[model samples]
Target chain A: MYGNAYIDPNEVNKTHSVLADEDPKLLAEFEARIERGEKIEPKDWMPKEYRKQLIRMIEQHGHSEIIGALPEGTWITRAPGFKRKLALMAKVQDEVGHAQLLYSAAETLGKSREAMINDLITGKSKYSNVFNYPAFTWADACIIAWLIDAGAIINQVANAKGSYGPYCRALDRICTEESFHLKYGHDNVVTLATGTPVQRKMVQEALNRWWPPIMHFFGPSDKISSHTEILMKWKVKMATNDDMRQQFLNMYVPKIWDLGLTVPDANLKKNETTGKWEYTEPDWDEFKRVINGGGPCNAERLAVRRNAEERGRWVREALKAGQTAYVVPFA
Target chain B: MNVAAIKELLYKVADDQLVIGHRNSEWTGLGPILEEDIAFSSMAQDKLGHAQGCYQILHDLGEANPDQIAFSRKADQFHNCQFVELPNGEYDFSLMRHFLYDHADQIRFEMFANSSFEPLAKLAKKVKGEIKYHVFHGNTWINKLSTANEVSKIRMQTALNESWNYALGIFEAGNFEAELKNEGIFEGENALQNKWLEVVCPLLEKAGLTIPEKSSWEPVLGGRKGYHLAHLEALVAEMSEVFQIDPTATW
Candidate 1:
């Protein structure tokens, strides 16, 4: 469910505003810890920008998980057999649970889960845009479970090496579970691709439909994207958008071809000389539009989440009625 | 042992689990609390897996595979009591139904654990272990929410009232009910129903909710004979929507 959190091309340029109010001595100490690969814990001193950026990154990851569950979750009832049903249920449950873990992780930095969720529903925060597109068929779900999760593991594995204690730990656990999801997804896609002609066509079409979104998943390349040198120095941003995308393509494209499913883009091939993938450029305009809420399922996805929030309000209220105090648990 | 009797018993048990499990799963991301969401999804997975376990027994007795039997059956061919097919209206209704139906199912499985039929007894025994948690979850929620607030109590009572008749249909006797009882394949529905009432009445009373009177109870029937409510057709269609795409595919 994780796609890179799309950075606004402008926000990166304004990050220095964080240290304008900080004691230069404390800022130097914070940088020294990050430079030495020490984890920045909750009680640790941090520049305002470090807290803000980590919260943004982790909260977006959490939102992606929950919203990501919706598209695949819809397939649980209709999954072809008991094996798929049980696995899909467990998989989607893991996604929601991941959101819980990640929200808690983000909470360690001082933002409340309620406030993070509020920003999500209000569109003040962004999740991976891949979810804003529909899972149009069973094969689409299969592709997501396999390919999108593949992308997440790529991004998350790199992020697990990050300097934040909680988010890194959460990513480690998340990657372990996502590995199984990758297996389940791969099994499903293999089944469809090797099935009857009708099924083969279905999976191929699904790949075709999803390939563009997958290409757009890691966000725009650094050459055309925001500069995040400060966050990188903090180890908060572990890999650039292009690096994660290439890692995904490098690992998955061959496996996708081995399944005998064609990549939708004719130009998709690895370069022997450059040792990198060469593919048609993902349309940044569409990525921008979708990330800004123009995709087919963006409205529907948020509305479903918003409706769940509204309908579930009374039960949440009733459960809270007798509780004398509320505490946000540590991640 | 009457094979038809055993198959009949299995169908109702398996169908109820599958249908209700499917309904319970609808709460996955939508539950009021995160813990409740995880709880409902876990229970849903257990119920569905239990349904599959029941179908494996049928497959040994020469039915189609579990997927085909489950996904290919027409709505009217389903043997689940209508109580389960009713949509999850709200958490109150869902929680109430879980409490009532699972109490009966728990006792039913407990009774079956001693069945003369060994395959069934084995499945029932294993299933009873999982149903323990289900009944516990149901009981805890009913107990907690019953006195939680005025609104919760009203909602719980109304859902209990609305669901009572369809719930009774869970005990509608099979055609081989007498033969099964004679062979000890299962205790008769009448006996199960009596025991179910004895167990449930105390909990309802403790929760300060009314038990619908026997004379007023018009137990809705025919679901055991493959009749169902309208909602069931739509549920079945949705369940098969993707599977029907390529019936022969491995997916």
Candidate 2:
């Protein structure tokens, strides 16, 4: 059991120095417990660095959920029929709910929800760069449901088995709700793909625009080695970035091909012998540029969010007063 | 019922839901907080879903496809009241609309749960489960905002004042109200309206606001008869852009 394990901080030499004398021993014992397939609970003693890494990863994930709504929210009014409108609305609602669940998980790390909001507003936090792009057409909505959410679900499903109790629990809920999102997307894609020539063209165009970003969703594999050892020791992450990226490609490439849609990457293919997907790597420089606040729609998206918070400040304050003035006339 | 009358009734329900759903959806990424953002989005979805249900019924009755019925219809053909179509100017405005509409819908759906039209009644019952959450959310905000701070109280008051007249219009009597009530298609609008006021007045009063003056109130007609404000045109245009591109398309 995890409770029975002990770690000595000094034993493991980390790139970053550890001040906690007991941290190295604790990490070793923690790693041993993980190798044995034990679960890590919230109250267990862990290295401060492990907690910090988890918070960074989990909080960014929470921010992504909130920001993710902007792209699809634009379509609620323009949805074709009542059924389509309702479906889109439900999907967007799920994104918001996912954000709530994720934020609650981050709160377990002793961060206030208010503080998190401020971080996002002040540009001190990071969210998924994919959201920084615009949803220019109705077809983009379907794309978001299929590709964007599909990417999110891949990471979330992996997190469902993460070490932290709160995070894993939150992931469980998020993954369940996300299935509806994926289905909604899949339904729309199928409909569009089978529709008239114009719709097919629209769906294809949307796929073209989204393919590269989806590839980048896994982040850079080589640039993120420092924290992997510790994260693995804690069982916070199940696989490497490259492994997860390959997994995503292997699953989705065939599905896209079945739709008769070509992914933007001409070199995309499956390696039969290795049982892995071999695809051209996305532009790592562009990924860095986007994450560093240089994406196409980043400014506009952030402005909208900041403005909403500012404009709604009065209402929040009004609700704080606690008084009732208007009385309805009885029947 | 005559085809024209059926079409008019269906339009009123569809347009009302579409407009209200749109307004609610505007809060998708902009809600005050994360959890509330999701809650608000869910409510918006429900409204759209209900609207679509009404549209589908009309289509089955030979009106048009739900998409065309929703998007291709001219502004003058829209039957939504002005209250539902107004922009979500502020959170207070949005919340007040939610509070009033949710209260009215609860009463409306309760009457509808026993509708003579079995299909409508069954759908109403299904929707009522979610509406319960809307009412709960609205009531929670009403209580929270009413007692919150001076600013929130003022904002809520102002929002309530702005929405008061439109709230009255939700009960506006269309030509079919008599026939609908007579045939047991629905309960009387006056009774539902009265119950709405009775239920909401105390809550509003307790929240530190006064109902607006009614002397100047006048029912704006035509949303039930395919007449609408200019906003409906632009809304429909954007909404139907994709569908209109190829009406026969699968999407």
Enumerate the chain B TM-scores of all models: 0.98, 0.93
Q: Kindly list the per-residue Cα lDDT of model 2 for residues A1-331, writing each as its tens digit.
A: 0000111223335625653555678778876776787766656776776676677677788778778888888887777766787888787777777777777777777676668888988888788888888888888889888877777777778767877778888888888888888888988988888777788889899999988878777767545423456556567766666777787787777888888888888788888899887888788778778777899988888898899889866665554354567332110
What does candidate 1's lDDT look like per residue over B129-197, in tens digits? 999999999998887777778887787788888888888988998898889988988888999999999
Candidate 2 docking category? medium
Taking chain A by itself, what TM-score does each prediction score? 0.98, 0.87
Residue ranges of candidate 2 with Cα displaced over 4 Å:
A1-15, A19-25, A223-227, A315-331, B1-6, B114-118
Residue A94 error for model 2, in Å? Answer: 1.3
Worst 10 residues of 1 chain A by lDDT: A312-321
Cα lDDT tens digits for candidate 2, B1-251 = 44555566667877888888887887888977666677787888788788888888887788787777777766777878777877787788988998998898888888888988777788789878888999999998887887777667787788887888877878877777777887777776688889998999998888778877778666555565566666777777777876777776556
Steric clash count of candidate 1: 0
